[model samples]
Target: MATVAHEILSHIYSRIVSPQVKELRKYTAFSNNVYGELLPTFVSRIFKELELSSHQVFFDLGSGVGNCVLQAALETGCESYGCEIMENAAELADKQAVEFQERLKLWGIKAGSVTLITGDFLKIEEIGEILKKTNLVLVNNYAFDAELNGNLVNMFLDLREGTKIVSLKSFVPPGHNITAHNVESPINLLKVDEREFFTGSVSWTDAPGKYYISTIDRSRITKFLNSQE
Candidate 1:
């Protein structure tokens, strides 16, 4: 039954996602490359490697189709939330969440709930309210420039200690002392805990795409920033 349900879900996904991606591409203003969905395998890897459980609260900043949050909710039964700036992408994500919720019920699984917010992540007034309680946060910022990345790191300062931040790129090089020469936009808070090359799909292609995953240290956030000053 599990195998049959997996096959059914695959068929449903292939049918729905092609048109959804097409419709979203027509409306996305940002670089489409950065807006692709994280593969299911990658999401599983994240949960397993991090030892995440139902006790965690997950947030996906700049969540494109909200796949990360959806996977977190379904796999770990974690409280998951996604913030998307693109309206079409947000709508598609909401639709997918509803569909997946129904499908999971058919498989006798009760997925954790998900919330999709359609707005700029930076402008979300409830970010602090969310981040304060969050345990894990995902950011797909491969396309973000230095300034925007700096802004993101600054915003993360509000997260409670012990929260984890997973990002696609490193804000700074690892094993280097925090000297002025090593400083990149004064993001002294986020300490790099892990860096690895991960393989995943992009744009419905069979060809594999390579991306970096970096985990940040939240416990040392404030202390590290103050030491740097």
Candidate 2:
């Protein structure tokens, strides 16, 4: 029944507003990338892997059209927030969010747990505070440039202990130049806990793409302190 509701919402959004996003495609060209929607199945699997709960807060950075955010809200009853840089995508997400709120009774989901913000996520003043409270953070940074990815890694450094961050791409590639940057690690205080590979549908493409899930290791601090002794 929950799966049916999820699919229904996906279909409704796609039928109503997916076509209008074409105007927004030009914006992605500047970044040498395109905004791709994740399949509901892939998102469902991710939520299952993480074991989200209503007690937790979830965030989807670079969230396009709020699919993952809405899904998380529906699946776990958790507070879900999504940040998208594109105006059209954000507007569409907000409109759909209103629809979701109106249909919450029919869907048997809680209200007021989803929010869609339109702007550069990096510029959000309270981003760090919000992330600190977040139990799970998801980022589809497959198209993000090195600068943006680096900034995102720095942002992760501010997260509370044991915060889980799942990304579609590695923030710190192998053999990153730490000496040149004068940072102990590519991500400063965060260490990759574990990485898992999965293939799933993205955007309108039928081909499945590989993704990575990583977490911030708070114990890295303790390990560092002990090494000094």
Candidate 3:
């Protein structure tokens, strides 16, 4: 109880929002519609579409509220991890993971535990370590953070089998999907996951925009990640 409380407080300190961020971030981008307490049914359905496994690793970048990680742990029996940079937000993720683990044990659920790291994804060295344990990477639709997302995507793509990357982009494309710095390639450089029309509304990727996933190759998931250059 004490540990969970402390972890919860850790998140209360790090995050700052304009109106309301009372919910979890979904997809690889950690985006949401109606933005509050877990993602909309639309995003969840998209996850179902992916059909991940227990042995593989699932990572959520910018894991707000650590909802996806908790969900992953509960459903897949796979190791769930969240990457958060905000000191307060990261703290919240850690606390959430702890809570989820406790709940799983109490229920005798055969789910996986989560590891939430507090740090910027830009730190290649640090992210590399996380990648070592990761099999599936998720990206939400926050296009502004595309540079960091791309770097992470590129890194994860380099791995081999048992490794898969999923980048969630807003279907709108123009709004949050990160711009491909150069014309050479939108996907070539970023390795975005396949785009899925998650929600019926245009606001799939938080803030009323379509949502899509920039997924990585399934066959080369682990191999590519292990062979990172």
Candidate 4:
């Protein structure tokens, strides 16, 4: 089933998305923020790993061109949302989304609803509300600076328990110890697991790299508070 979905997504990208991107690139210059992409096959694997279902909600922060967002909707039938700050990338994402919907109809597939927003994800009020119920989030933060990543962590503090966040860079350091002085830190509420991906998993590089899945689990915080009592 996953293989078939991958084939279909590849076809859709080839037919509906690639041409639009090529045309857009001719007129627009993509900013450094608009750098990486999660390939269709890799994204499918991520959906499976995260156990995304029809009832779940998926969000892609800094979603470049909405490829991962479109794939999520088609593969899992989950409510999909993407926010891109780059104007040129956001414009292309909107065009790709329109074509993606049309192509889905042509293929006779029923996909989940897709919403693509153009703005700073941190400032988006709707995203804050959505995070409360979001099942999974993807952030390609390989090139993100420390300040931006810290801001993302602050925003993630609002995510409901059990929400899974996948990222190219780990939010919580390895063997992060929760202590009295920093017991209130957001990192205490997360359980992070690391995994590796081989070459061709992403658009930025050909070498193998690692990724992190941080699950929102406030049990650690609760346990710590209980211990204090």
Candidate 5:
């Protein structure tokens, strides 16, 4: 019954003013990378691979309008948190969170919840404390690319001890030197932990073409995160 209700509402929302927050509206006015919706099947597959717990807390980094957070929590039984840097985007995400929860309630889904944050994920004042309560983190791989991705990874590593990072990376360094640099930077900073990664190519609406998604293990990532703290 609840599932049916949520689907009805979601279908209606797809036709309404969703993803139309005051601030986010203007972003598309200039650059048009805003994805109001993604392929549900793809997202669901990715979420399953993330291995989220229904009772645990999940955080979405660079969470545009908070869709991922809402989806993960609603579908997986976890509490959801969305971190968006842009003010307008945050506002939109907040709106989405509220509506998603309401829709869930109408459909009879309970225990799951969602929250949104409007600030830099790297310097989100006192975020480490908040992250202490979280168990899973999702990085929209194409969202960071090669730019602030490193900093964000380091930040997530400093989060909770058992916190898992499931990032979608799209960059592959041309030279081993770049790889060495990523390897040595954290080591020199005196932070080291278990590290693992898987690399592959895929096409996303955000990237338009196939690109590499380099998955990093927690041990190696932990060293960098701990160092940043």
Candidate 6:
């Protein structure tokens, strides 16, 4: 039997979202670091891997048009939040969110709450508060610069233990080591797992790439401290 979520989301993509995306492509040209999208299949895989559920809260940093946010809410019944800094993209996301709500009524299906915020995620005080309670966070940091990635790491420091963060680029460097000198670094608190995504998983490129799942484990810091003692 086809799940209610699958049926509704299929209809929404074919009827509601596809046309808007087509129209958007006519005028909008995305540049590096400004926009990218993960396909629905890829997102579904992520939800499965993370075991997302109704009891959790999901956040998307640098969300482009709220695709992942909408999917997370409707499919998992998890409260979903997305923040987009680009004005045009944010406006489109707002419109899509409105339509998404109305369409859910037509299907007589209930979905989790969705909140779309338009602003610099790093500067948004409300987002900081929400992050403390968020169970999972997604950031499409494929094109993000080192400075921006560093800033994101600082923000992740406040995430609760066991919170998982998904990103296109690994926040913790490949060869990172927690020595006494850098014991205070936020990287020390994360345990990252790298995964491969084949071509067509993302909108930016046609080649295969890697993504990372970073779980906040304060125990790492504790272990380091205990070793010192």
The best candidate in terms of TM-score = 4
Question: What's the candidate order when arranged by decreasing TM-score?
Answer: 4, 6, 2, 1, 5, 3
Q: Write the per-residue lDDT of candidate 2 for residues 179-217, one digit (tens) a residue.
A: 434445636454454444445456645665566666676
1-229 per-residue lDDT for model 1 (tens digits): 2244335445546655667766766743555334666676666777777777888899999887777777788778789999988777787777777788777777777767788898988888898699888888888776777777878877876776567777766666556565556444335555565545444434445555444444445434455467878
Write candidate 4's Cα lDDT for 105-124 as tens digits. 78788889999999999898
TM-score of candidate 1 on Cα atoms, chains taken together: 0.80
Give the residue spans of candidate 2 off by over 4 A.
30-33, 175-183, 186-188, 193-200
Over 1-229, each residue of candidate 3 has an lDDT whose tens digit, in order, gives 2234224333432332222244334233442221332353443454466666677778876666576776666655678887766555565666656655565566455666677777766564766776777766666534445555445545654554445555444322343323235323324333333444533423333444334454343533334445654
Q: Compute the lDDT of residue 132 as modeled in candidate 3.
A: 72
Q: What does the lDDT read for residue 143 in candidate 2? A: 78
- Candidate 3 overall Cα lDDT vs. reference? 0.52
In model 6, which runs have C-alpha deviations exceeding 4 angstroms? 1-32
Is candidate 1 or 4 superior in TM-score?
Answer: 4
Winner of 3 and 6 under lDDT = 6
Model 4's C-alpha root-mean-square deviation from the true structure amounts to 2.6
Candidate 3 weakest lDDT stretch, 10 residues: 12-21
Question: lDDT per model, in order?
Answer: 0.70, 0.75, 0.52, 0.84, 0.57, 0.85
Q: Which pairs of residues collide in candidate 4?
A: none
Model 1: lDDT to the true structure: 0.70
Off by over 4 Å in 4: 15-34
Poorest 10 consecutive residues of model 6 by lDDT?
24-33
Superposed Cα deviation of residue 199, candidate 2 (Å): 5.1
List the candidate 5 regions with Cα displacement exceeding 4 Å. 1-9, 12-25, 28-38, 143-145, 160-162, 170-184, 187-229
